[model samples]
Target: MTFSIVARDGDAFGVAVASRFLAVGSVVPNARIGVGAVATQAFARVSLRHELLDALAGGESVETALEQALAADPLREQRQVGLVGCHGARSSTGADCMDWAGGLAGESGDVAYAIQGNILTGPEVVRAMEEAWLTSAGQPLPRRLLGALLAGDAAGGDRRGRQSAALYAVCPGAGYDECGVLADLRVDDHPQAARELARLVELSELYFGGPEDVESLRGDLAEEVQELLDHVGVQGDSVAEALTAWAGEVNLETRLTPAGIDRRVLEELRRTAGR
Candidate 1:
């Protein structure tokens, strides 16, 4: 009843899932850096989420964690599993008795993914998903993930149907400070939920910032920011004050913390660059 991809991008990693079932995220996805990402679906087992995540975190590779988990389950044939780990290791399994269940694994640089599902059209779903992942060059990871999900859907996903969808990820920068989810959201039953969720993620990245996005804006800082602000129309004290308020409310100060000036400085810059 679900199709999902567990992937790692550079220093960031995430799991995206779409299903014709309710609360798929609760059972179908498990992920961590030191460990791996695991998705257990079909009949679905809640315990496997934490158990697999914990086992992966303990330093087990994707294959080992999945083997141990499936080994303990007597009803393994009625299930589907996928996993990916820190060293870019990946593995997937689909029982012959699992009614159309199948999966695929890919390894490329710091990026890797395990795509799988039950009630899916064999490798077609995985192929489409992988194609989207490979073709989405120069795009953000979140966009690539959504593109993969949409490709799977187009190729025939969850033979039973479509309903809820979700996205998840982890970043070390989030530990520093951020007022947002780690890209976790659920579209319980919207027909266009996956697309909608992708749009939300893009919007969030615009107003706030993402972990993978920090580095490009960090170097030779002050001049570049002034140029960007000047280009965006932040002239005059009154307008700059508004910009300052906007930045503060969104906690963007972390990017400009090196400026070391009073809020008035931003306000003046805004006034100078008035639209």
Candidate 2:
């Protein structure tokens, strides 16, 4: 009924999942910065999501943690799970899981990934996801993870149909005010949940994205930019102050720097002022 990928990218770890069930995000995915990520489905042993991450945090290898977690569950044969962390990647597909249920794990360079699904169209679903993840080098973790999910959906995910999807990612101090959550997006219910999830990921990048390289505001450029900000109703005694206030209003404080405003922010201010 669901497909997912748990992966480690550089110092970050994340999970992306999709399902024919409503609000799959409420149960299927979990991640922690510097520790690991997990996706528990099939029968959906949600608690195992935390247990697996805790085990990884305790320095257990992916295989050992999965073995112990399965050992503790008398009904292990009905559950499915995927795990990836500092140690590596692993997955489990219980014998009692529905037909077409299975999983795969692989690593390339610094990235390790595990893909799993139950009641899926076939092994092709997992294979396509694996291929996509392996080939998405240099892309951001969320985009890479979401690309894999989209590939699986294209290969025929969840034999039933799409109802919900989610993307959860984390890197050290990546969240708001350095809180740790890099991205946590969910399309709780949508006819095209995977596509909707991709859209949300794009929005997350715009709002929470880091700065890009571009020339800084200085001299006459700074004054002209400040005039634009004032024209947009963003008031301040100075250009930097006005830009900072506008950044806060648009939830883009992360893009500000002592050198100058982000090029993207400056462009946005100009665009809005022109409008």
Candidate 3:
């Protein structure tokens, strides 16, 4: 009924999920900063998301946290879970889950990941996710998770067809306004839910994300920026100031640098000016 990946990359912990269920994101994924991530599906006990986080925050290993969370549940045999903590990764496929239900957990260098699914087309879906996760090591945490998620979908995601998909991740200072949330996006119902979720992830990067590198405003680039600012009716005494105003108006100020702008900002300026 669902397929998901839970992972810890550097200081970030996140989950990407797609399912035939409505609003799978609402019940399948949860994480706490400095704790870990959990995804409970296939007769999901939504409370397990927080229960697993609580156990992990209390210093339990991923395995222990999962075990403790599922210990008392009477329908545990019908529930599936995946977890990735600071220490390691663990996954559970319930005995009573539908055929082709299973999971994989492993480490790629310092990063840990768990991939699981139920009622999938085949085991190849999970395998594709694993391969993508391993090969996408150099990407940002959000992109890495999204890569694996899209791979799984391309490999044939939920057997019942895609209805919802989500990508969520968190790290200190990664979110807008200094919050820990990095990316929290979901396509609640869509024919191409996974791909739609990926599109949302890209938009999130442009809006909520900051720049990786910045270049000083000078010469032609500066002139172009000022022109675009004027075209957009954003007034300022200088190109940088006008750019700042424009970026702020569009909620992209985070990508601005001191006396400079990131490539994303430049591209956005071009877009607003319709060039």
Candidate of highest TM-score: 3
Please provide, for model 1 over 1-275, each residue's C-alpha lDDT reduced to its tens digit, 9 standing for 90 to 100: 78988887776667888988876666676666445566777777768878878877887767788788888898877777766777655545545545577778888887888888777766788899999988885666666777898899888887777777887776555422652234665677777666766776765554344223222223454454456465764544543343455456545543343324333334434454562
Error (Å) of candidate 1 at residue 261 is 16
lDDT assessment of candidate 1? 0.67
User: What is the C-alpha lDDT profile of model 3 across 1-275, one tens digit per residue?
Assistant: 99999999988999999999999999999877888899999999998998889888888888888887778888998989999988889989989999789999997656999999999999999999999999987788999999999999999888889899998999988889879899999899999999899899989999988885677799887888888889999998888788888888999978878858898888888987899
Clashing pairs in 2: none
Q: What's the C-alpha lDDT at position 47 in model 3?
A: 85
- TM-score of candidate 3 against the unseen true structure: 0.97
Q: How accurate is candidate 3 locally (lDDT)?
A: 0.90
The runs of at least 3 residues in candidate 3 whose Cα sits more than 4 Å from the true structure, single-residue gaps closed, are: none
Tell me the TM-score of model 1: 0.76
Candidate ranking under TM-score, highest first, comes to 3, 2, 1
Segments in model 1 whose C-alpha atoms lie over 4 Å from true places:
175-182, 210-238, 247-275
Candidate 2: residue 193 Cα off by (Å) = 1.1
**What TM-score against the true fold does each predicted structure earn?**
0.76, 0.93, 0.97
